[model samples]
Target: MHRGREAPICTRMSHPLVFDRALLRARQARALALGPEPFLLERATEDLSERLLTVKRRFETAVDLGTPTDLLSRALAGHPGIGTLMRAAPLAAGLAASERTIVADEEALPFANGSLDLVVSALALQMVNDLPGAFAQVRRALKPDGLFLAALIGGGSLAELREAFAIAESETTGGVSPRVAPFADVRDMGGLLQRAGFALPVTDVDRVVVRYGSPFTLMNELRRMGAGNVLAERRRVPLRRATLLRAAEIYAERFSDADGRVRATFEIVWLSGWVPHESQQKPLRPGSAKMRLADALGTTEKPAGETP
Candidate 1:
């Protein structure tokens, strides 16, 4: 229990996880509505794998939690970053031959405690309902002094799109159901990691601005990349033609750069931490500091009560 807080335990990885299923379904539905494309999550996994292979050449054993499309496996086949390690699960056949064993949930990883030297998560953590529990699970899976790396969309992402829509809706009608979903702020995420008992937690932001010809074109790309927002208890009404047109006008007029292209912001928050190690210890010697009794009285003499 926390010292002064009465919030429910936010660190359980038990059965029937608490993620917003409606959100997931809504995202799925939105993706289907837009076009045929895999979610941005899969791409995140691939990018994470590539980064690990590129920088951390010393780490041989690594795991990618929620790996979709066997991205890590394929990356391992060639330059595979610097380490060039092989995937634990080999590809069998077909397009997904490189697909590794699928773990059911991130809240409870299958690996034994202290087994993994490194664990990487792509864009999947945002979808996790029980984020604290998920972090605890990651901590348990890591070896002593092991490392964990991850990337997730930050709160600052898509500010332009969100604001444009907000203003347009207020001007045209009363207000419309918000399209973009809320994301974790860097400070909140850092606190969650600390609460999960992760040590040396650090976060950095990656602001990616994607240019689009129009709001519909931007929506099309999001659908293709499967990056639509998913929120529980989602509003089901279709966006009216007027709303779309107004949104585009607002986007172009307000969010357009000097180049006259609409800019969509994506603030990717990257974080890394290491497992706390019991071995980093130091024993104190008894009576390490001597009492300079003579100097106490400013006369090179012990006080009357001194036993030395």
Candidate 2:
């Protein structure tokens, strides 16, 4: 058995605040007003729905956590397995016109302990300053054996654009500034789930490569998707026109294809875990198996350092 004091479930105090969440919310609201792009949300909701279909049990109470759009809520609506679907977002402008909609922050869920049967989030959580704390809150809100599913933008999502911006800024102004938000890596997500006291955690990546006419088109779409840079340490001054032009040139030169189209990669990291329960499957304890590996394979066993 492990010794020493157990760690705290919420680690907000340990993590540094990264994103300007208020600015992110404002940008999201502005994007909504300017006819926000819904393609990424649509793809995420469809994938989440497909994953939910594979689950054998139904969820009586489910919440769509912090999704800026109603795509997830609408997708889950009228589903045979979903009884009552609620939507929550950090801003009122992001909430849909539903009776169950609520303004709630992802970092601090409002649900009581063991209250929710299912919690699903799409295209959110990545922007949260305290992801570990948010995940712990989700685990706390779930009942035993309850499910949590989420899809967030992950590392490698904006590699081309990030590189272009860095190179162009350095070449034009002799310095680089924070122009893109950092994303979580897939390898760390499973450990995060385990740290949050989840059982049978699983994490996977789905890379979506979208081809655009030019770098400017991709940038415009990113703004429309409310994914513009909101890093707390971002440079306060406006990006220079010369730097922007140089960035475009760098992007076209490095990431363009034979047809002159540029590729924008979006790495969606899917995470799923269940609240720990006696009913859930557990790994067999060491030396508890009835049959040996040699017996199972019908092969003669040999001692270590022994030669036949």
**For model 1, what is the alpha-carbon lDDT of residue 63?**
71
Positional deviation of 134 in candidate 1, in angstroms? 1.0
Instruction: At residue 305, give the lDDT of candidate 2.
Output: 91
lDDT by residue for model 2 (175-239), tens: 99989899999999999999999999999999999999999999999988998889999999998
Q: Where in model 2 is the C-alpha error above 4 Å? A: 1-12
State candidate 1's TM-score.
0.70
Which is the leading candidate under TM-score?
2
**Native-to-model Cα distance after best TM-score fit, residue 264 in candidate 2, in Å:** 0.8
The residue-level lDDT of candidate 1 at 201 comes to 82
Model 2 accuracy (lDDT, Cα)? 0.89
lDDT of 1 by residue, 1-308 (tens): 11243323334545443346545545544554555444455555566655665554465456766533355555544444324232321121111323344434554455666666777766657666777777887887677877788888888988988887777777777876667767778888788888877887888777778788888888877665445655554456766677778888988998888878888888777888778887544355876746654566566675689976
With a 3 Å backbone cut-off (N, CA, C), the pairs that clash in candidate 2 are none
